[model samples]
Target: MMAPATTSRPTSATAPSTFTSSCTRRTDGVTMCAWRDSGTRIVPTSSTSTRCRNPATPTRRTSRSVNSATRRSSRRGSPPRSIPCVRCRIRNRRKSPPGRSARTRSRCRRVLSARRCACGIDRIRSWLTRTRCCFMRRCWRSCSLVLIAFVLAACPTKTEGGGGDGSFEVQDPLTRRLMDPDATTDERIDRVLAEAKPGNTAALPALLRVMRHRSQAAFLVVSDGKARFGYRTVELRETQKDTRSMERVAAIVALEAINSPVALPDLVLALDDVNEVVQNHAARALVRLGNRAGIPTLIANLDNRILQRETANRLLEEISGKQGFIADAGWAERQKGLAAWQEWWAGIQASDERLPIEGRAYQIGADAEADRRIGFFVDVVGQYQFLFHEQARKALIRIGEPALPFLREGVERARKDDNATTRAGIAQILETIDHPNGRELLRDLLTDASGSVRARAAEAFGNLAGKGAIAALQGVLGDRDPGVPIAALDGLGRIGGADALAVIRRYVPGEDSALQEAHILATFAASRGREQRDRTLAMLLGVSIATRNAAHAVLVRITGDDAGYDSLATESARKEAMERYRGLLGG
Candidate 1:
């Protein structure tokens, strides 16, 4: 074996020098080697060892390229070396042959540019992660603050001017004390009336707020010992405990006493109050303020009960300088009066003229001097001049209850002469008084010899809904004058009851189409059950086409069923359809 081992030596071209070398794998999966030269310089080795012998010559990769490769290898979890082997740089670069054109060299550079990296990718990723985390934290903090602010805003909080007990506190001490529950009603009302002087705007808000409080209890009393109920107005004293009404009335009075135009809007709103007393006070306050805006309200009140009508007439005369036809006129005459006033209003509006208050202040006492003036006006009501008669009627109405006695005396005197106009005027005045005795007096006037007086009395009874008046109206249903019978039928309908319905039914069979129509309307108004529907169905067989058509209309209105019947159809077709309607009603 020693003789067979012959000595072998490396050829000069293929032998490597006695230098140290290291090998490493790059991120791109290429093996690279670096050599340590004799001068202690690190030189990158190419694929072939022959290229590494000339260590003084520059290799494909510089120190900058090696640093970039090291950074790329660190990001990709590959082994990192101080320098990349020359073989990798040479393989990645595009080498144009020598003497190539400039365009070829430029294309070669662009083609290899993608393989080279300039900055550290891993360092950029680390900076982005830190920046994104910081931005998200700031955004989360801002959103949390906004959510907290929204939650706090949704909850209720005490305002600066609120009381500890959570009620809105008024700035005025006297108003606060007046509104206190512990205070006596009389004492509070007295203080409110005393302090709420004219032009005291400071007390207005508190006073207006308390005006809506209901202080009165309503009750029905039987005056005639029958089924009829009459409304009685009673004042709630301090002993009653709840004085809201007393306070509201006092507030309204104070607003009137103040006589300020600023209170006009509040007073106007008070006109529609549920309490009659409040409405009365508000209306009078508007009159005192010298504003004609209350004219329409006063006109509407002409149809109300006695106290309100009296006040309405007084206010109307004071505001318009013209007599209200509603005061002394009959129903037909009142229509004329309304028309005249409406025309006058239209003219004033077209002209755009300011309505000047006539400085007419009404005196408010029932002294002897006031009584004498009332008596003089009562006498002048029978005077020759129409204007003087109207003015006198207005004056007597304004005197209110004090003129009732004189008005009764006038009624008796006019009855002796059988004066229709004078008796009507006096009877209407007494009706407007709406006293129990005044109603009785009107009942007696129903038997008067004058047809005109009887007709007017019937209308008054209708408006009053007099239970006793039903019998008297039934008797007048046969009156010679058509107006008397028409008025009687109207009264029966207005005073609706079982007896009134019976009375209306008696006239339904009559030949007078007008009276028959009135009967059907009154029956519908008084009765509202199977009995009325049955009676109305029987009326469809009436001889008069007009009466049958009217009854058909009432049936449809009550039941909301037309039953295929047409009013303008021929008699045979209408009869056939009516038969069908009867079958539908299970007749």
Candidate 2:
């Protein structure tokens, strides 16, 4: 009956025995197919079971069933050698849609673009390999190093190329010219210097080069050091119109080269030389030297009918110590003191819009009740007072007689019941005026109530030092106030002459620990030398005067000496630079 299910199934399973075992009957009367391989069984029971075998004849199937059962028993004893595939209902229905994943697409696009870019780069690399300049890299590196070095050098430092020290050194172009053997330049320079009144335009460059010894001083006079030097010597000697002119230019080179007071007399004579060129150069040289040697001569030259007032003014501006080096030197050098005093007085009078005494009285009354009222008004007056004092002192020696009367009146009035304000102003004004009353007033004000007034009085007394000022100034030396004593010390320092050393030594004491040491250092040669000079210069640089006072000092000190004190004028400029740098750094 089941006659044979074999009736429907193949006897030898022509369908290629996918099932490895024969059919078998279960206890429930259900038939099953099974297969066996390597002692493992594949049995199909439910429709959900996995099929890895084929079914054949019952005999073979029966054998497979027995073997499959045995394998199953063994499989139960041992673990599976390979994992079975898992079937997930969710995976079957889920579609990936039309596009590949974003990551895969991006990767593919990148690979394509990279391949193209690489191909292009390969072409460029090949071209460069064949045709690029061989020395390009070397040249680039060398130029870069040179540029870096230039940038570093241009940045200022404390080394040899730093600060103003390089200002005095030879430049590259000048160096080249000096090294040249050609006589054309020498001849050309000779003819230029030989001109009767050499226009500064053509002569300045050649002169500067020659002066620095960067170019040959061929247009200069024949001298002991340069007679056999070279074509420069010949050209210079040949260019001289006369011995006088030669001597004048020669003196300039010597002054510039030597920087000595001994050259003063010769320079003074040249200031009055009949030749205009000689006079101009000599005056210029004296101004350049920046010592008292040429100051009297320069002042005396002011009387020249032919010299323009503008020229005189220019010369005055040039020679006056706008920064008060002469002040640092003290007014004892009468010529320097007078020059500075006159310059200071002139500046004060020119800028003063108010009646000097009346204005201070009104200003003091106005500020009398406010918190900082006194200081505010004092500062306002002090600005003009200090500025003018500085300028007047530098140029007054040149002004001489013109400044006396004003100086006398202020000094005379300041001595009696002078309020601190009035006394200070009067003393300051008198400081520039060399008249008798001016000296007397300043001397008397030395005993005033206020420290500032006394300071002003002491400074004025120093400025007024004549035979008359000695006793009064020395008396001021014994004042009770420390600043008063310091001021008196400064005055004595500037007024040095016969009573100078005794007074200087009286309070000056040992050069080592005195307050006057700064003032004393540059006024005259102390027992100490360079050390004194350096300390004095440091004091000048470090002393923190008010802004206008500092500006006035810088302007006056380098006046005339720097062609116009341009280098020295930069004291204020440096302050401005600091401010701007601070802003940039967000400080």
Predicted model with the maximum TM-score:
1
The residue-by-residue lDDT of candidate 2 on 1-587, one tens digit each, is 11112212222324312223344433322233333333346432344222112222222223555556544643343212111111111111122223645323322332332334444667545534543334444565698899999999898553211112222222334323422334454553454344324222323333333332212122222123332221111121122223223433543554444433323323444454555445555665655544233444444544444343234434545554343322223235535645664676466457843321121111112222221211222222222344423322333233233334433443444445344554576566566666665565566667667888888887777676676666776676666566666666656555655466565655543343344543454243222222243333333334454323423342233222212222234666645533432333233
Query: Can you give the lDDT of residue 30 in candidate 2?
Result: 26
Candidate 2 lDDT at 239 equals 25
Candidate 1 regions exceeding 4 Å error are 1-369, 376-401, 416-418, 506-510, 528-587
Per-residue CA lDDT of model 1 for 460-512, tens digit only, reads: 78767755678878878887776677777767766777888888877643577
What is the alpha-carbon lDDT of model 1 when measured against the actual structure?
0.57
Residue 258 CA displacement from its true place in model 1, Å: 17
